[model samples]
Target: MPDIKCSVTECEYNSDVKCGAPMIQVDHNNVPKSNNSDQTKCDTFRAKG
Candidate 1:
């Protein structure tokens, strides 16, 4: 797969500044639609144990 960069160090799916998941889900943080990066969230994020 192409390199998918990620900066969430606390996520279990993050690997060396990249995403190791087969796929990632990005959803709007609250509103129905997102107009910017800050308005969105990584739904696939899982805290490292």
Candidate 2:
């Protein structure tokens, strides 16, 4: 756990302001290489049921 901070309340892995997933998978969206946070997204995010 890298102590990831999360704010996507709709995600199941979000506990408070921290991520509770065993691990986080983040990758660039569309762009071949991301140069900023806005270009990346969390692949570990699962919608809360």
TM-scores of the models, in the given order? 0.88, 0.90
Pairs of colliding residues, candidate 2:
none
Best by TM-score: 2
Clashing pairs in 1: none
For residues 1-49, what per-residue lDDT tens digits would candidate 1 score against the true structure?
6788999989999889999999888899998988999999999999999
Residue 9 Cα positional deviation in candidate 1, in Å, after optimal superposition: 1.0
lDDT, each prediction:
0.92, 0.89
The total of clashing pairs for model 1 equals: 0
Instruction: For candidate 1, give the lDDT.
Output: 0.92
**What global local distance difference test value does model 2 have?**
0.89
